[model samples]
Target chain A: MSTSITLLIPLLLGIGGFIVATSRARRFSDVGSGKMHSLPKYHGYLVALSIIVPAYLIIFLWLFFEQSVLRGVIVNALPDALTNGATPAQVSLLISQVQQAASGATFGNPDPAIVEVAGRLREAVVFSRWALPLVIVLVGLATAAVLVSRIAKRFRARNYSEAIMRGLLIFCATLSILATLGILLSLLFEGLQFFSRVSPIEFFFGTRWDPQIAIRPDQIGSSGAFGAIPVFMGTLTIAFTALFVAIPVGIFAAIYMAEFASPHVRGVVKPLIELLAGIPTIVYGFFAVLVISPFIREWLGSIGIAVSPTAAIVPGLVMGVMLIPFISSLSDDAITAVPQSLKDGSLGLGANRAETVTKVLLPAALPGIVGGVLLATTRAIGETMIVVMAAGLTANMTVNPLQGVTTVTVQIVALLTGDTEFDNPKTLAAFGLGLTLFLATLLLNLVAIQIVKRFREQYD
Target chain B: MMENVSFATAGAHARAPEMPVKMFGRKVEVFYGQKQALHGVDLEIPERQVTALIGPSGCGKSTFLRCLNRMNDTVAIARVVGDIRLDGEDIYDKSIDVVELRARVGMVFQKPNPFPKSIFENVAYGPRIHGLFKNKAHLQEIVETSLKRAGLFEEVKDRLDEPGTGLSGGQQQRLCIARAIAVSPEVILMDEPCSALDPIATATVEELIDELKQNYTIVIVTHSMQQAARVSQRTAMFHLGRIVEVGPTEKMFSNPDDKRTQDYITGRFG
Candidate 1:
């Protein structure tokens, strides 16, 4: 059976159960001497959930454990002569050969024992495919019959349906949290592996970052240096430059929008400003590469100062343009969150508009604004596409924005782009940089949340 | 007929030998977008006295109070027509800078809204903005005197560096009053300044208002009739966006000339 058909069987069963249960519930309401406790639609939803949940559970569980169980079965069924003293890697290799033969992609000639095992694997796959849909249909029908029989005028179907809805929401929320945790764990594990190969002291504190490891023992260059300070410094330089550009412009824009702009102008202009965020970062990347970088180079050259075409300022400035809406929108929310009574108090005290905003409104809104700036900083730190397209590949420890410097994200991309063995320190170094970036961003987010929480406590 | 009677009382009050008009409104009408909020309100605020505007909710008393300082200019849709004068100068004239006018006519709002700054900073903000001091000591003197005048200095002087928002509700209101006084405005407009306060706090504020009127002309809007009778010398009763009566506070409460005022004072209908 095809995968789509297998999926469709349970869906069709659920829809059929819905229709049947709905009509039955309607009939119960008509015959009973009281009003239905739950709506007929809720009854339909309850029946549908009963059918779909159990059926999909079985299908997913079967699919999840099928491959490993099949591999175990094949390993167990192999003759003692073939498996007796083989290492796990050799056994895994033999299993792949068997799978290749099973899929009719075998090369040259094959041994009789291996060919027999391949035949058995093929038969098992076919049987499992057919068995899955059969079992799903049986479970769906069984659950549908059980739930439909229990539907009554006073069944309280809405409660059951709502419970299922709540479970679904919890499941979605947990799924995202679990995904984040999974990424963190994977980064930690791989980063640990990288550290095992390269000392943590050298990786963290060393000022040089060269991840190119010689493939051969006698290669021209020595082994790669994984000092992350330069990359971290590059990231900081660009992020700070971006903030330098973004903070003043974004804050002024927010102030103007929140305090000075008329409602008619704000309604039109706010969305137009926010539209800057909607432009994809990748588009911003190319815009930086194709437009800003060369312009900076030419403009600087004319001023009798030399600058790289991929100077840190190019992507830094462009990313700031990209972040303008982000900072402005968040800042606008913070500014607008300030109570009008404060503004009135200041104005009533004979302060002018600018005086009120600077002396009263800004101080009151400082925590919220700081939180927003921190969030934007994290965004600038983690921004990849613009850095990748417009930043240099070399990690240089320079404070000058006119020079080219590579960030952790750019280096991570450079390290992992082509074919490479995962076990090598070169590839594992990407994980190390990733963990570093993640920790930095996580720290920033925690601080931002703390500041924002304090701001809320002030108002509430 | 009711308008004529209210005008006659206002005229009589304005002609009183001891009291001089500080702020006057002549047929002041306020419109918010297309909705008319105040209709031809005529009232006079006497110098060094508390004039209370008394009405039920949505009666436009606060509207008329805000019109005294042109605080209505802050509301985008609010439009004020007719003449409102401060010390016999037309306040709505383009030549009269609103900022300077506000410095001469300060306001206190219904809620206690102190700047999220230290107690000292909150009181000093007005002086700092207006450049009212020659030195830091002068600024400090202004702050101390303002706080003392608002009767908050004795309570808050120990924690002058603490955030003003951390003060109790009543203290915060007093802090706001101190802030308003720091600039030394001639007239003060208070819009239900004690509504958000407790009874004890309200009493303290009412007493402070009585004392403040000796130096500053005060116009207050209050929902509580008892609060009006207790704090104000002259009272104006607003109903349905128009003044039904204007007279001495004791007469308005005891023997109002208009039936609406009589009914309102006796709790027949608001």
Candidate 2:
């Protein structure tokens, strides 16, 4: 039978089971004076689920293990002369040829032993597909019929259904956690591989970052230094410059919006400012390269200072503009959360509006404002598309914003772009960089959380 | 330094002999948007005395007291009509700066709202903003004196640098009173200041209010008639956006002229 027809079998059983369960419940009600413990619909759902869930599980687990089990049995049955000394790769290739032969693809002249095995493989696949749905139908119908026979008024169908639902929700939550753990562990293992090739001390503190590897035995003058100081310095300079532009502007805008603007103006203006965050980063990168770099270069050239078009400031300024909405939105919430009685106290004491804001509201909102600024700094450090496009890949260690620099994310992208061998130290270094960057950001976030917690406890 | 009034002569105010009026209101009315919150009412607050406004909830007593210092100006839709004078000067005139008016007429809120700062800073906030001191030493002197006057210095003197919010409920209310007195305002208004406290804290604040009556003309809005009788020398009863009666605290509590005031104070009906 076809797979769709096999799948429809359980669906039809579920419909038939619903009718049987509901009719049985109604029939049992007529024979007894006792009331039903649950509504008839719950009994119908229980019967239907008993049919579909077990049938689907049988089909799923059979499909998961069918191919590997078949492959292993066929490979073991092959002639020992061809398989005794073959490497794992050759064995894999040989298995594919046998499968292709069974599918009638023209690959090579088939040995007689291989031809026999391919024929057996075709028959086994045909038998397996048909056999699975037969067992599924029998098992599913039995479960549904049994569930209908056992459907009493006291069966807790709703509890069972809700427990299943809760289980599904937990499964979904664990899936995401598993995905994150998988990525982190992969980065850790690959970083260990890279460290085996190059010392970790040199990778962290060395000033040179030449990731070249010699191809020939006699090749000379490719040291492959892998010093990450210049890259770290570049990341810091761009992030600091971004903060220099973002923190003051974002905080001031937030203060004005929360404290000064009337409700009507604030409603219109706040969403407009938050709209900056909704724009895609690639579009911002395009604008940075096309607009801001030229503007900065021309303005600086008039002052007799030669600067590169791809200077770090171009990306840093653009990223800062991108970050303004984050800081402003969070800080606005923080400032607005302050109790109004404090303002009344200040004003009743003859303090002016400016004094009330500076002396009462700002100090009360400091911890949350610091939280906003720290979050914006993390985004600045991890920003990639703008840095990759506008901040050039030259890892210059200079503090001047006019010089070109590259961040860790930018280098990670550059390192992973092309088809490259994973065994080489140069390719492995990306994972090392990724792990280091993740750890650094994690440390920063922990410290920020501590500060915010301490400050909040002090005031509130 | 000043002397306290003896309780032996407290009943003298209940008689027909007239005392001088400090702030006078003639035909005062208040409206919030289209809704009238205060009727056309005439009343007088005596000089250097505690006048308690007693009424049930939503009687407009708080509204009438807020009109004394133009605090109603903060509500955008609120409108006041008629003349209310402070020391015989019209306070609602356009030339009267509201900040200076508030400086002369300080207020303590229903809830203890101390700024998130040290106890010393909480008291010194008024003097710092007004530039009332010649130096740091003078400012410290003013803070200590205000705290002492508010009866808070004995409890919080050792932890002057600690946050005022960390203090107990009654201590925080006393700190707020010190905050108000630090600026040396002539008249102080309190709106249900002891409502958010326990019985012990309420008794302490009532005692403090009576002592504060020595130097400041105080107008307090209260829900408890017993509290008004305990601390106030003069009492005014408000009901349904109008002042029902005004007289000495003893006469108002013992034998009110108006049926509404008599019902409210005698626990007949509010």
Candidate 3:
């Protein structure tokens, strides 16, 4: 059987189960429609779930255990001399290569004995793939047919169907929550491993961050320190600069759109600002590196102020421009949500448009506007591509925007991108930086939500 | 009662009617887009008297009230055609200042819309803008007197620094009234001032309105006939953008001259 045909086994079983259950449900209901409690589709779904859910569970179990069992047998059959002194990761890599060689694909370090064992494993896998899916399909369809044949005029198919549906929805909800918990647990385990190697204090507080590990034990002057302060400081400086640029422009644009501009002008300007947001950050990064930075460098040269070619200011400026649409769109919605009667009250008091906007409208929209700025702050902090391309990877601890800096995310990306050993502190330090970045953004988002909630209460 | 109208007529007969009119509107017509909303409205609003305009929905009663203070100019598509005179000077004249005109003639809306500010600031906004107060104490006095006149002083006296939006709907409406009165305008226009308020609050505002007419010319647009009859000496009924009947409140309700006005007041047709 083809690979796709094998995968189609569960799909066909599910469809057959649905068809049989629905037809039986209809026949049962015909005896007395009032007696049946739930819909026909519910019965179909119940039978389908019973057929596929358990069958897939068994299939997954079998696939997992069978692969391990077969791999163990092949490992045992390997020559005693070859298996000695190999780590678990290296052994797994060797097994993968052998399996590839047996399947008529090129693999590293070809060995005749391993090649022979790989051929046997390949043949077994091909046979199992052909026979296993056929057995599953036949079992699924037969079970569904037998269940449908047992349904009688007195059978509570509808109730049974509803119970199945409720279970299925609950199962889906639980599955998502469990998946989230599983991810968090995996991150925790990795972070714990990172913490064991580098103390949490050194990771968080010690200023000089240098993540370079020696591959060989004989190498001299090897040092791998993961102090995250410089990275965090760089992130804060860039993010603050971006906010300084984005908040005023975005808020003023939003106020002009909401209060001052004519509908015609607003209609034209709103989409253009949104278009600025739609342009990808990578494009902005490109503009920052090739055009903006060069121009800024030349301008600084003319003014007699020395600036690095890849200064943080160019990246901050480009990121701020990228964030303008995000802030403006949110602020516009918040300003527009302010009640019209408030504006009228201020105007009725003989206050001009400017005074009414400043004293009444802006104050009412303050929380929402601040929420938008906070959201933009998080976005700027978590941004990777702009800082990676525009801001140079030298971690400089200075407030000057005209200096090279490296953010945590950019460091994390650089650490893991090249040929990295899994056990080395150099590569594992990325996970530590990632955790800190995640926590910082998470805190920022919570603050944004709180501000939005306070804004809502003021109006509602 | 109808006897009150005759009593005023008798008083006018004895006094030689020597006092000149404070404001006059001539042939006022308002159009929203292509639709004419107010058709040839002409009236003389006497100073320090409450005039109530009563009509069903879409009768241009609110439109006429907005036109008195040139609030209609804010709407991009709305056009006002007529002459409005304040103290014998045409308000729509080329040289006339709209800001001064609006300061002289303050307004109140149907919904109580307090600024997102302290209670004191809400009342102080108008006075501060018009330069009606010279110092802090004078401003405080104006705020206190306006709040007292609006009957909101006792309720909000302790928490003047609290946001005005924290007040109840009725209290907020009175706060808006105090805000209007703080500027010391000669005229105060209200558009359906009690529509969103409860009965008790409506009664309170009605009492306040009766008292306010002693000092300021009050023009109010309302849908409630009883409210108009209770607080207004003169009532104007509008039908389909036209003033169907306008006369003394007692006469207009008890014996309406126009058929449309009679039908409207009798609850037969709107």
The top-ranked prediction according to TM-score is 1
* Candidate 3 Cα misplacement greater than 4 A, ranges: A2-35, A44-94, A106-123, A131-183, A213-218, A222-225, B1-24, B88-94
Tens digit of per-residue lDDT, candidate 2, span A60-83: 898899999889867986789889
TM-score each candidate.
Answer: 0.90, 0.87, 0.89
Please give, for residues B75-179, the per-residue lDDT of candidate 2 as tens digits. Answer: 768999989999888999988888888899999989999998999999999999889999999999999999999999989889999999999999999999999
Q: How many steric clashes between backbone atoms does each model show?
A: 0, 1, 0
Model 3 per-residue lDDT at A373: 92
Model 2 complex DockQ against the native: 0.68
Which regions of candidate 1 deviate over 4 angstroms?
A: A15-47, A66-129, A144-166, B1-17
Ranking, DockQ, top scorer first: 1, 2, 3
Off by over 4 Å in 2: A1-87, A90-165, A449-460, B1-19, B25-34, B73-82
Which has the better lDDT: candidate 1, or candidate 2?
A: 1
In candidate 1 the C-alpha lDDT for residue B163 amounts to: 93
Tens digit of per-residue lDDT, candidate 1, span A1-460: 9878998888898899999988888886354555888878899999898888778888899999999989987897678899999999999989998999899998899878888999889889999999999998888888888888898767888999899889989999999999999999999999999999999999999998888888988889868999999999899999999999999999999999999999999999999999998999999999999999888888889999999876899999999998888788888888888999999888887788999888878888889899989999999999999999999999898978999899999999999998979988999999999999999999999999999899988888
Residue B246, candidate 1: C-alpha displacement in angstroms: 1.1
Better of 2 and 3 by DockQ: 2
Across residues B6-40, which tens digit of lDDT does each residue of candidate 3 receive? Answer: 22223212322223467878899999999999899
